[model samples]
Target: MPDWATFAGFAGVVLVLLLLLAHASKSAVSGGTPIRGGVDRPQPGSVDPAVAEVHASLTNRVRATGRGTDPTHATQPQLSTLALLANVAVSQGAFGLLLLAGGWFTEIPPSAFGVTAPVLSASTLGVGVVLGGVLYAANEVGASVGERLGIGADEGLREALAPDSPAGWAVLLFLVLPIIAGFEELLFRGVLIGVFAAGFGVSPWLLAVGSSLAFALGHGAQGPAGVVVTGVLGFVLAAAFVLTGSLFVVVVAHYLVNALEFVVHEGMDVDWG
Candidate 1:
């Protein structure tokens, strides 16, 4: 059996960190900056091409609706892509360290976290790619349905996170998204559900619901509708993890979903909402 006391300590730290992140997200959206209405607008007088492009896109969206972009958010500052990347890298790196430390202290093997070597195959990767593509399509369909129903999502969050330069895009796609996907899956799926179940003998499906709620809450920056959408997505990912028992698969699929969202929505300007 694993060390219950140590596991409790690890869980406590993780919970605190998750709550902090969620609060920060809420603060980012709920502060003087309105949620950009439908899409993120550029900072006033910004010359960055990416910002310019986003502004143009936002303008077009507003024009299509025969309305103007929200003046409240017109002057709201856009987050620097590099700064956002650095912040995510540092936070996720800390999470990785905590995972390692917890494993060391509790004597939990990596397998308990779903890190297995045997599953690292081309076929496994292919499976992830397929799953990711399908999930992305499903998400688009859901978003379209939600839009038709007048249930709006916060596309501004994604727009603001989109990169401004080729180099920034590369970093976001190759490094940032993968780290986000990996750490999230490891914490939400592998540890919260998988390890806890193995260590405490609780039902993983129940844990899935609990962890999925946490996962959804962690994305509070995405707004209320986003929270609902994320909760459903989290559960689907959790189900995949529970069934496949492969962190690799879920990470890859998660990465693809995020990467495609950024690429298609922001980069390609194919707005589903």
Candidate 2:
């Protein structure tokens, strides 16, 4: 177990890294803000209803009839990933600072981060995969139930996962999904749990429950049922972290849940646009 200073040093490095990444991402997206519908049109623009209808019809027809992009392959989504990336990085960086101020990184278990040989055993890999699969199934079932109860998912999350090309899916699987999972676990589990348990002398289960509530409430954008489902899942994840003392375990499960959601439910779709 590392004392507060050791943990703070590691967190400081993470803070600096995330801040740099966020700055770069924000700069990259400084141009081309996403606009939505006619509401997003430039100021001082006005149109007659009949002319607008005609233009709308033509645009829709073109979208429906167009086969594919030109060989030049000049196409892009209405939005960019940079904004999302920047926000995540900035938020995580801020969380790092909070952890330092609160001395939340005190007395971390070595197993928390899965410190081990460079090469993992096959059995270890297998166990991780199985754990991830189980969590993935639970998350999916929770999301489904939430949807049935009219608790819509976060809009930004939905748009991000909308079906796109294989390249897009690959980008998410390799780059975005793991980053999100790791960031969330680092904040909610690693930092928050440490803060409560070590800083406040909270027991493991109590810290897990308390931090899990915060985790779920943080997804306030996802609505009530989303809060409920996520809160439950968050508790389970926190409990697992406490029991196994493996941050890697929770990260893997979280990543698989997100990746599977996108690939299985939202990756492949008949082109409707």
Candidate 3:
């Protein structure tokens, strides 16, 4: 196994990449006309008076609050959301290049990098589906437990997943999420696990645990409970990677979990809103 110092340096590399994405996201856009997706979902208050204000002032003695408290409720262009989309793509791209460069330097085979599925048997796909369902159920229970413990919910992630408008929802569900699932599985499970286990001669299971922790920290914006949930999911995928060496399996599983969240919230109208 590599020394603690060595692992710390490796962690620093991941941190630098994450920090670069975050910084770029902050500076990527300016407040402009309604974003492309905003046409179908205009900022609600922009076109109308505050209904709560009118009601409170004119019709009732009690003061009432409108949707003003939740900025996400209004359909203005969310520069942060746009920036997040760009950051995930750019950061994942960089991660790919880094792995390729490492492969070349280390004289490692491309297959060793875990980019392609070594084998995709029907049994593997079936296992992935079962695992995906398990993750979804576990996350739901974990979230409820977290809330009871006063950890609250991961509103930040919910905002990204469930955009305010139809177009925003389309982009998030179709474009952004697939990319997120593919790239994340590739980076964490394929790349990170391969590097530590092969290059540093670390135990593959230990490397999986390390990558899972990094995955959790990557979602620091979601707070502690959110990190725990993400870490648990990461660990699940990592174990799958170690067993099957099937990139497709983890991607399908990850995508399924994400899709389930959207379906529950948007389609079923469950109250994570």
TM-score of each: 0.80, 0.60, 0.66
Best of the two (2, 3) by lDDT: 3
Best by TM-score: 1
* Ranked by TM-score, top first: 1, 3, 2
Stretches of model 2 off by over 4 angstroms after superposition: 1-78, 81-124, 152-156, 160-163, 194-201, 270-273
Tens digits of lDDT, candidate 3, 28-112: 2111112222322211110001111111121111112233334443333433444344444454556556645545555555454
lDDT of 2 by residue, 1-273 (tens): 457556656655554554344334323222311223312111111011111122232233324545223312212332233333333444544654555444434655533343335334565456557777987787667666655765534333343324356655555567656666766676667765654355446687887887677766554334456567678878888877777666676777777766666566565532221
Where model 1 places Cα greater than 4 Å from the true spot, the runs are 31-79
**Superior by TM-score: candidate 1 or candidate 2:** 1
Question: How does each model score on lDDT?
Answer: 0.68, 0.51, 0.56
Candidate of highest lDDT: 1
Name the lDDT of candidate 3: 0.56
Superposition error at 163 for model 3 (Å): 3.6
Predict model 1's lDDT versus the native. Answer: 0.68
